[model samples]
Target: MSDALAYDVFAKTCPSRGTLEHVTGRWGGLILGALHEGTFRFNELRRRVDGVSEKMLSQTLHALERDGLVHRDAQPTNPPRVDYRLTPLGHEVAGQLLGLIRLVEGRMDRVLAAREAYDAEHEPVTGRTA
Candidate 1:
């Protein structure tokens, strides 16, 4: 790895932050996870991931495609159906993401318990409770 001099996350040239935002986007993780299962069309993606609007799905897919993580295939059928699948690079990234998700799931209960404990300790007793 080359030694970089500065860290300006807000700069347009800083891909690190943008990449994190892209991967953590609302539909991004789910889209990657869904694609991990197999290739699917736009409608199928929407169906698999609950509560995603068409606009959001389109935007997410476009973003992933631009990032070179997703491959879009458009067939010359009458209706012009398109399918989306993960590129090899996307597969590698998705595998890492899945590992992260699995780790979070495993520790979620402990994390929640810690949050609740902290909140209960910090919160002032209401007049009714007092």
Candidate 2:
């Protein structure tokens, strides 16, 4: 919270590196993106994120929550309900990620072509079949 304290993500000991990893890692990004749509209970979020296992989802959510990007609400009911949503900071980060996702998706054809060309050129050396 100090303006004098600078964060260099590339630095080996930088705390920002951990936060960046939490925000951009596989499960983290998907969790944030899904939460960007709206608030969701744990199971709902799990379903929305598709392939995330319960443990991974729980861990990612905890990390994001600690980073102040995700908000977790626990309601006391006969069957307790917990909901997850993006904080203002989370929304900002998710918005940027969504743009990157859209760009990659839109350019998939070019990406696939490049991959094919690279694979074709290296297949023999790599001992990869097909």
Candidate 3:
């Protein structure tokens, strides 16, 4: 057998957990999904993944880049230009995430109904709504 170490994401001590978190975290998934469309500048990516603060976006991008799921290209000009895109691995992962995203979006009606039913069943008699 090859000496390459295998990673199991479910293992408590495995490093894959951190990468998984970076890929699935609130901002990470959105960033990856946005980048899957095309390469984008920092500000453009920020706008694409709305509601993310500049600092948070920067941090998330750095984490994703470190995980080799993102490629950061810097160009030297009168003003520096930076673009972010997905690596091959990132593209594969992003495709999977997009599938999940689409599934959730397509089933929102059912999800909303389920939520309402759950709330109705669990709500207090006072009717203040939880």
**lDDT (Cα atoms) of all candidates against the true structure:** 0.87, 0.93, 0.95
What TM-score, computed on C-alpha atoms, does each candidate reach?
Answer: 0.82, 0.91, 0.91
Q: Write the per-residue lDDT of candidate 3 for residues 1-130, one digit (tens) a residue.
A: 2432687778899888999999999899999999999999999999999899999999999999999999999999769999999999999999999999999999999999999999999987775665
**Candidates 1 and 3 compared by lDDT, better number:** 3
Model 1 stretches with alpha carbons more than 4 Å out:
1-12, 128-130
Residue 61 of model 2: what lDDT? Answer: 100
Of models 2 and 3, which has the larger lDDT?
Answer: 3
Our tally of clashes for model 2 stands at 0
Tens-digit lDDT string for candidate 1 (72-96): 9999999999999999988988889
Candidate 3's C-alpha runs over 4 A off are: 1-5, 127-130
Model 2 pairs whose backbones collide = none
Q: Alpha carbon lDDT of residue 10, candidate 3?
A: 85
Sorted by lDDT (best first), the order is 3, 2, 1
Clashes of each: 0, 0, 0
Clashing pairs in 3: none
